[model samples]
Target: MKASALWPMIIILTLIITACSNNDEASEEVDEEDLEETTEITAFMPEHDEMNFEENSFTKLMEDEYNIDFEFETTSWDGTAANERRQISLASGDYPDVYYLIPWVDQFSPSDLIRYGKQGVLLPLNDLIEEHAPNLQAVLDEDEEFRAMATAPDGNIYGVPQLVECFHCTWGNKMWLNTSWLDELDLETPETHEEFKETLMAFRDEDPNGNGEQDEIPLSGSTMTQKESIIPFLMNGFIYDDLETRLLIEDGKVDFAANKEEWRDGLEYIRSLYDEGLIDPGAFTQNADAYMQLGNEEPNILGAAPAVHIQLFTDNDNQYDFDALAPLEGPNAAYSSYTHPIEQGATFALTNKASSAAQIKSIQVLDYMFTEEGSLRAFFGEEGEGWKKPEEGDVAINEDVEPIYVDIPEGEDETLRNDNWAASAQYYHPVEFRDGIVQVEDIYTEEGFERRLQEATYLYEDQEPEDVFPYWGVWYGEDVQDEIAELETNILDNVDQSAVRFITGDLSLEDDWDDYIAGLESLGVERYVEINQDAYDKYLENVE
Candidate 1:
């Protein structure tokens, strides 16, 4: 009785234990499944070769924390191709749930936002931001300019902008003079337009580089963008030349700078430089690479170059040799072309295709990027890996502010790390946040390049006209948007070409200036100004 009963009892107990273990395993599996359940949001983003979204730590963290999965439809990072793909997606009615764009690569313009929002292709983000995005709402509430930019004339928020307060970007049209050449020639830093001209003459004639061949490009720039154009830096000495817009605001009224008498004088001054061989002929036609080649020449042939940053034209070896030249005092007034610190496009947008759940999740994810911790994680990767808290001796970029974080240096050879979403996730980086980052004390060092830019930008700060045109935040009506766009293209093209011709002596400023004005008028310059004036008025109302 004892042996048989004992064996039966032991078997029963073993069977019960195994059943409980099976139940526990089943519970664990169910919990894992629950954890894996995530809202799938299809996103259209610019493809960055250096980043692998699948292996990205930020992507994983967002998926885990927000319980959202991103199915990406990537377009080439090339601006033209990326924009084309974005348009094609919209045109084909196959657009993704959301678009996460990189500002430099490609993003939706205000017109795009307005058009898409009106057509119901893009969802109005006003409600989404109000309900789901506190961090973003705080920014909009705090920064009137940002709010003005984000809001359309119709009072609907169509998309979230990449709010990057880049201080140096505010003064984009800047001239970097070869201080080494000045030292070599024993010439002081030029304070006026005449002085600058004399300095350029010295650079051209005195053999600044010590090369007997006279291979020096006295003043050079690239045609890649208006910021690289030498015209604005020189023309600013006569009139406020914003390079791109060629518009000026006087007494809160939109006015065309190119049509002004001062503009002609500026051109005359520039033409004189061209006549004297002080201005490089290639500056108006060459691309960035060619301009950079001139800058990086072995004997340092570039005497001066106009660029937003020296790094664009010169490498680390020659960057230190150049110094920022403040806006030269002309006959009229000294002025520096001012670009708004905030980028001009919307980087994050929700499409009508997104489900209600997807929209909420997407906004929440975007809102996270507006937060400092989330912003750092989304942009710079996890702390201690991509960045770390500053050490005791670390100095902040803004010296008055305490250093918050220090970036970990990546290897020169390492292109792809698959750690973070590069520039695509940059939603909010305010002045305080950017300036709080640790920078090396030596502004000449590679690690302190940002500080160098900051110092350089200081020289150009407050040098803009008393009432500069607010181009960045102004929104145009759909009725006038297309018309304005057309007129702008034609007028700006003519203005640029005419200016070039006038400078190169192909068109005499005295004879051709009136014809140029007539051509502009035919292209509807007055109409352009009128439309912009209305837009600017609307923008002022919003900001106020």
Candidate 2:
């Protein structure tokens, strides 16, 4: 009772004593507690079906593990206008605490880094990673190109990149034909250019899709989509460096490949096909929607098209209804494919406004996305919680399947029916997560699985050698970006326009061909190549 009554007086006396005394220890303790609190980070990303992983992302797992909180913001993949709205925001200084700008910002720029870093907007991460991060340092140390690409021309790094080894990206234009159609018509896959001509003719005449009327399109494709590569992939095979898929650095300067003479040969092949009714008249004018629609609804209407895999029918993405044939051989007797490297992972840059601790925490959080456990969690989702791990009791899903991830076995492998791709890949998240450890349940329709099996089982004859050519990554100084862009765009426009005229018979390859090459030269084709070559040389020198 005495204590209760005296409590207020005691508290007042204690407060008075605390206020008058030097209470540095208590204040310091309070400050230390505040410093230990988690930092908040916000990231901006362009929207994609794939990009939506952040909410249920691996980063979230890392955040929970490390006690760092990172928030993400996003924008549309493509707007009505082709202009990048995310980039516009970045340039305008409307940056968040962090940005996951894979669409374009992965193409690191020295100028941007200098501008942002000098303004104290982007913190230099070299020290942070050198101390707090070790795995990322291991990646940089092991990969030379990754180092070159990650480091800015100013001798500093501004972003991170993706470095998975992809063998197929370089030589991608090869498409599979419906060999079932060839068999129905008692025809074979084309070998030489002349044979290719005959094959398309038969495809048109044979009505292979089994429709009563002659509505089968012998060959179909688009020049618009990179993956839709019915044109450049084939065209580049014929030309040395034609069809500037993206800018290429040659001996020393920048160049557009589409303007080369071999490109003319490729176009002429297509023109010959077009003139004979073996190609779709709308090959150039058609959009992706139209092409994809035809693939789904009128599977029989299409006899041939451009694609890396049989999935171009994409309707039966998991099915095997279609088969691939090799690219038609050309005049020079050369067959090669130059695959593009998988692009670096998009940027997840720190904002200038982020405090030093915030920046450090932000990168550490990003580093988590690259962790073995983190990548799997972000890419595969919560295992057992979301995915099932493979067991000794069961054949792993991929093993149980016949053809695995488009890599089918030869001879006896085809007859033996195994449903692996469906059981394994199956529109599964994180495609490269391969056959063991984590497993995807084989959950595909019969039609889907069979079609995929059929497609993989079919033979693709005389497939060309894969060419490793130079593809421009954004380690380049922007000194030549404007000109390379201008020249390449103009060359592409002119090439397609002239190609239509030649294919439509309005212009002849023999007559308009020389003029076209000359026109390309006049439009700075040589200059383009020289610029590319120069850039490559400089790029090589810079790497050393």
The candidate scoring highest on TM-score is: 1
For model 1, how does the per-residue alpha-carbon lDDT over 175-238 read when each residue is reduced to its tens digit?
9999999999889999999999899999988998886988887998889899999999888888
lDDT of 1 at 398: 87
What lDDT does candidate 1 reach at residue 227? 91
Please give the clash total of every predicted structure, in order. 0, 41
- Candidate 2: how large is its RMSD? 13.5
> After TM-score superposition, what is the CA distance of residue 74 in candidate 2 from its true location, in Å?
3.6
Specify the poorest-scoring 10-residue window by lDDT in model 1. 21-30
Task: Give the candidate number with the greatest lDDT.
Answer: 1
Candidate lDDT (C-alpha), each: 0.85, 0.55
Position 360, candidate 1: lDDT: 77
Q: Which runs in model 2 stand beyond 4 Å of their true positions?
A: 1-35, 46-60, 76-85, 102-120, 164-170, 241-260, 314-319, 333-336, 393-469, 542-544
Q: What is the lDDT of candidate 1?
A: 0.85
TM-score between candidate 1 and the true structure = 0.92
